[model samples]
Target chain A: MNILAQLPVIPIILPLVTAPLAMLMPSEKMGGRAPFVFATFVVWAVFAACAGLLHSVATTGPISYHLGDWAPPIGIEYRIDLANALVLTLVSGIAALVFPFSYESIRSEIDRRQISYFYAALLICMTGLLGVTITGDAFNVFVFLEISSLSTYALVAMGADKDRRALTASFNYLVMGTIGATFFVIGLGLLYQATGTLNMADLKIQLAGDKNRMVEAGFAFIVVGMGLKAAMFPMHLWMPNAYAYAPSAVSAFIAATSTKVAVYVIIRFIYTVIGADFSFAPAAFAWLIAPLAIAGMFFASGVAIFQDDVKRMLAYSSVGQIGYMLFGVSFGTEPGLAASLVHLFNHGLMKGALFMAAACVMLRVGSHNCSAYAGLARRMPFTAGAFIVSGLSLIGVPLTVGFISKWQLLAAAFDSGRAWAGFLIVASSFLAVIYVGRVIELMVLKPAPADAPEIKEAPLSMLVPMLILVAANVYFGLHTELTVDLSERAAHALMGAGR
Target chain B: MDILNFFAERYNYWIFITLMMMGLYIVISRGNLIKKLIGLNVFQTSVFIYYISIGKIAGGTAPIYVAGDMESRAHGGGHGAENGGGHSAPGADGADALPGKDALGAGALHADDMPHGDFELAGNDLATLTGNAQGAHAPALHAAPDAGAPIAGAPDSSGANDILAAPALKIEEHAIAAADAVKEVAHQAGDVVYSNPLPHVLILTAIVVGIATTAVGLALVVRIREAYGTIEEDELESADNVAEFGAARAQEAVA
Candidate 1:
């Protein structure tokens, strides 16, 4: 096979191989800053590989690489269509930025000895997420999902150095995540029993338009399971604490990528393997998941307005953001799915930037609460500046990436004759404004308390990546070729491929 | 009749439901961290049983057919395989067949001439089938070398008989006979109908994941113990509530 043929598995394998080596770089006799450099190199390589994969998928349509030439329908296949290619690029692209940002950002947040190990864990987590996105095998998705979830539990608990609350948060997540994963496995087993195949493409062919009870039960199981992982409302209990307690760099990376990938899996299972034609699926999406999406938007954003802790507030806001993505899914039309995919990409850019800004604040002020942020705009000007730009994006202000998502989502809603849902989206934007406005008011309008800690602007390491993401928010907002057009194409590909 | 068959033949589903619910009940009802993990293990084990049982065919043998077994059974007029006598697919068909048994007898794999491996063991497994059948098996039992036997009791394996009770071993011959008696059934002269191997293979991968989950869960509990000094969920709750809000608010929240 040529090098390009082997490109799909590299994003998964390269980081998995290099992460351990990076972790081992800090031995007592041979210690240096090499581990950080190596980990950064590894993430960027993965990012480049994903870019190549995306290019290949765009040019050639979908690329399916069977593991070791084992052939599809029997062996595991790494399917790189437009849909997963977009998600792969988003995840690795976030990891690429977050790695260098974390070098300086996590210094005050975690123990010194745990730094290299933390980077390694981050690499493994990235690999797992990438693996989940690329595989066409249903059970392989579970395998990679667990790989990521297991590491995430450890990464979130690493916050225990800062607060014991992180421990409880991690344990709570472990219990819930395990139950969620097992539910997913049960669903997979049922699918395997019905079709006698684990490959997603094969399952689609075998399950073509047959709305039997076994498939229906499996569909329900798969949704609820992935719902918990994607931080779908009511099942999103693990998310806020996990994000709030994690190291700031980790909070940024995970917020930007992990739940987004879970959202991708939900889309994959529903539209691809299960197909929208299933008797129960469209009805369920309209009745169960869509209403939950509307409820989460109101409930979480309203709750975000009351939170004293900025990190927890942002985490709640993330739940509300996911509601927008799922709301797009509820429409069940091509434009609707396209709108969902667009938000998935745009949300990654915006949320990732927002969290990195919070990280810069955490680096200096050493507090997660909004009170710590009182009128530091003059002192940490760049940090507050980046925060304002990203915060505006979060509020769906014009000429930022957030507007693109809300515009398309609203358009899709109205196009599908769900004009009330469009109104709900607008109303939710107001809730985002209230919550985001509270923080903006703190950073901009309010005066600094006289006793504010004598703080400087964020370090170059943090500011550089945070600014790059913020710039991308403006860049892609102006240029819809990448986010809007590509996502719609991805949507068309997914819809065509599914049926 | 269909309903009765549905209930009776599908006892595995009933047992799966029972074990699954029991594990879930334990996880939900327990407050102790370790007990919750134990419940999770039970829950995971039920899934494992469900998957592995799904691989079982009611009348089929294990999916473990040796390439060597097929080769030996190929040389019908010959003594045993050049690779040494291995247990076979059906039995050696002609001159090497069993005494007083039909040369075409399906499961009666006469191993009187075998030099190595589990042909004797395969026959002795049928000792439970009929007491009178196996004095002929006595000399072969001692000669059944453990070396080169890939699967020790493999030849006796019906996928159903493997996980089933010891008494199901006796039904292997009858199952094979009853299977052959049906007109719709088809087989080669030597091919053993194997249960689907894919589910078992899938379960093996799943078991690895289950172990990892258990290990990670326990490790998280260890960290939790170090942090909170307790693994009880309620105690950790009160401790977290106190840590989050002030003592007064934590008390009110608890109430």
Candidate 2:
């Protein structure tokens, strides 16, 4: 047995184990920097494992690691299909990039004594998202989800060191996130009651064509639950304030991974566990998911246009971006699902780069207000340039990741005979251009106030990782082989699993 | 008459739904942060109860193995599996055991071509170990408990002295032999109605997650109280609003 077969669980366990060890490191001397350095090393290693996992899952059908040598249908299995592997790589890869950037990002937002705890919480959050993505059992998803949510609450609260409002933001998120998680568990219970299995594969076998009300109720509960976590429209009240008030590093990392993983869960449940062939699937996809998705895209992008706090604006934009993904899922066709999956990866790259750029600006400017960016292009040229490029990408400009997502989504919509949705998508994207354009106007076109404080470029450690993410945004935008091929394969795995 | 019968037949579900709605009501309708966390706990606890009750085999005992089956193996969390990852026997990564093929490429995943990676690595009978849990329900289990009640609020603590069971039920680690032994003993007895151990184990994990969430939520509340001098949502909201458009926001933060 090669270690490659054993690779699926490493992404979860390595961080799960490191988080505690990181906390125990002495608070004196290099111990102050030890947590950050250690976290970076571990996250990069996880990225390697996740990349390897994707390659292996691509080659070996799917990799299922039975926890403790126990066989599945019984043991808690870590299953890695192409969809999961792609998401795992995206999450870990973003985390790996964000960790290095946090060296400077957190320096301003957190106190020295709390630095270790911050890194610890970040690692645990990483462990949780990875676990949620990799697990094959339905209930295991809940366990890992809560692990992430709890840590996320604490991570957000750590920002109280910078702004007292972060405490309230974290508390609000806690209440909402817990409710969402509980709803998920309730759904799991109903599914278990109907099928007598918590193993997802086993549940699928049992649920293939059941017209069972109990199972249907479970599906509704799961969608709403995951929808709340995914920041589905109308339920996204917590996101803006939470992202706005959070430490920059926390905002960037969570923005790039958390909601995307939740959306993946929603897709997994709709297509895989419940099966698209189920009686409820078509109406739910068309009326429920698609409409909500389109509304969120327009509604949120409109709200984002007015936000003075740039981070919060990005957060609102995140809600809007999620709409395109859901819009793709609404089609319930292979190409449509592939579009969502592709956008899923591309959005993570775009947001990770954008938020990191925001962090760089925050470090230098001490503000996230649009007015704060006046003449920022002259003062902090490289950071402003990164922001401009990523902002353009967010607006779906050509030769950027955002353009790829929009192109695929539009194609999927047209193919599925939902040409109206394709139009709506393009229309919503212009809303993106409005908000993105406003920020670009402040950063580039306007001049700095005469009394404006001098600002320096972000420290090299932060700039390197931030620039790397920006590079990935462009590289993947041009290089469709990796993202598009993997996404299509991931979509196939998800579409096939239900059958 | 039909409506009454519907409620009567699923009274356990009635309890589940009532508890769920009550908890949800409090969470949405309340203003205090601490109260909201309490509501969340109630909501989560209801789910635990719901799951436990579902795994309720009528007249079921706790999931410990019966007179023939070795019941002690369950204390190690029912599945009695290793702690995942670190304990795996090395070369477990030998991807060769899993038949290599691109999923969307040449070979479509047939049941026959399915890679039994774990079983093959352990050199166990891949079929018996399970790909067996396929096609859903196995035969009606014999009247017997399999093992473990780690969930504090578990409904099926049958014959247990306390939460999920006693110290005698504790088994830190179970070997492959333990699983075989339990199966053999279960086959012999064939008469005990045992709770499926899975939900018990799952609820146990959920309970821990619940506790951690409560702890974190309460911790945030404490910080909120310190920072804003209040924990009520209205008070916090007013404070944030004042900060949002006020120049005093910058001055106070500096102070």
Candidate 3:
């Protein structure tokens, strides 16, 4: 047995082990920062493992690791094709970058006694996401999804130290997330009954030419369930408060990775398992995903512009950004799917940077409200600069990662002869410009209060991660080989698997 | 057939659907967090029942195997060579046999054949045969020849007789003998056909996942109540609204 072939499961195992270890760390008067140190090291190891797995997959094609040497169709398999490899890299890489930043981000927000538990929950959440991306079994997806979601609820509730509203936000999210997971399992049950198999590859083979009502019902359930998790359109009611009220580190990590993983699952279910030939009818695409995608773009952006809280504004903007991804998927073409994949990676970078910047500002100002941001540039120049760059990226300004994805998205929109969608995409970016510009205007243009206290920039631990992610947005924006190549391969693999 | 008859045959499905609707309704319509969690349990349990029903094969026993070819196993030393020579390709020979047939004990059964009603008869016959073999070795085993002796009456009987009687009538021993006989037949027939253990295993996993979700959910609810002092959805929503309005006014004052 080549041990290198087993590298796919290490990303999951590293964090799974790290979480409980972090929990076991004594937080009061004993282990000052041991939990943070342990968690950061493990997250970095997960990132390395994911990077190695992605490289192996890109070179050797898909890697199949039978857990305990059990073969597929009988045993659980962890299959990593290009699509999941890209997501695994994105999720673990973001977790690695965010954990270092979280030490400083949580120091003020969470109590000293609860800090270790917070780190424990964060690592478990990371493990859940990695597990979801790596597992090839349908039921395994549900299991991992709950693993991540349950921990995320706990992590969100930790924000109660800073704001009690975080409690309700976490509760609402728990309820909705549970419902979404149950629906997904119900769909998995239907498919298992119909196909006598739970493995995605086996389902693909068994479900070929079998388009009964039960299969169609399963398709509906899976899409709706994943859509709720992805926060697609009307199902996104729980997101704004949860993101706004959660601790800034949890916000940055979850905003950057969780929904992206859900979208990846939706794409996998539709293109890989259901087969785009059956599920991707023009009428269905136009009638279902098209309206929801467009509605989420405009409605969310519209709601965002009116928000006073900076974090909540960004949360609504996150919903609008998800719209662009779903819009790309609605085209049901290679370019469209590729554009969605590109945005999935690119938006993760941009939003991670933005939320980290927000965390830095919150460190100084004690609030994430727009009014608290007046003349912030004079006090925290480095963080203000990071936010400006990422904010511009959110607006799709040229030479930023957002521009790259939006350009691809628009090109695909027009390539598919959806001129109206192209126009709408451009229009939504302008809405992004307004919301982003509002922040820049408040931070740079407004004058400070007369009795304003002198506040230094965020600590170096936080600054380093924020700058690194901001640098990635600019670097990948200019040299798009790695992201574009990976996304294109993943998109082609997905489309080729369909039908 | 009328609709009632159709539903009667699939009463489990009808019950699943009804329980699913009730659970979904409770989850959506209830305001209390704990009630909603109970609703979630009801919903998830319905799915479990649905999956278990999918794995339920009519007239099928538990997925565990019972001996199907006692004659071949009893005379296995000769039968293996005879069948291996006769069916050069074992898979094809197994596929050719009739499913659910009682030709198993005569050494004519194949691996693909679904064990049916005759499987129990075959097990009893093997149990008796094994019993007789033991009786031959130890004539003292014939102390209590009552095959179905009441266990309550055993205490009044001779101690040795009670031991012999209980062992002969033990269900587990019968099952073990049957399984042994089935394994021997499986070796002769080239494979074992089972009642789709995969779904049962997968659903067992799903049920565990469901319980984990419920535990986490209830934990969150407990925490939410501790912090907010209320776990009712309406109360929580109103509190959130009040907080939102206060923040808005504060922002306006700063402006």
Q: Candidate 2 DockQ category?
A: acceptable
For residues A302-354, what per-residue lDDT tens digits would candidate 1 score against the true structure? 99999999999999999999999999998888899999998999999989998
Minimal lDDT window, size 10, model 2 chain A? A24-33
In the range A187-234, model 3's lDDT, one tens digit per residue, is 887887676567898788777777687888888888889998999998
Please give the range of 10 consecutive residues that has the lowest summed lDDT in model 3 chain A.
A276-285
Candidate 1: Cα lDDT at A162? 90
Q: Which candidate number maximizes lDDT? A: 3
Model 3's CAPRI class?
incorrect
Report the C-alpha lDDT of model 1 over B132-204, residue by residue, as the tens digit. Answer: 1211222111112223322223333243233222211222233344432211111121223345566677788
TM-score of each: 0.86, 0.84, 0.83
Provide per-model DockQ scores.
0.22, 0.27, 0.21
Kindly list the per-residue Cα lDDT of model 2 for residues B121-166, writing each as its tens digit. Answer: 2223323223122211222233222124222233322322221222
Off by over 4 Å in 2: B68-190, B246-255
lDDT of 2 by residue, A183-277 (tens): 88888878876765677886787787678677888999898889889999978988998999899999999999999999999988887788888
Q: Candidate 1: lDDT over CA atoms?
A: 0.78
lDDT of each: 0.78, 0.77, 0.79
With candidate 2 superimposed using the best TM-score fit, by how many Å does residue A403's alpha carbon deviate from the native? 0.7
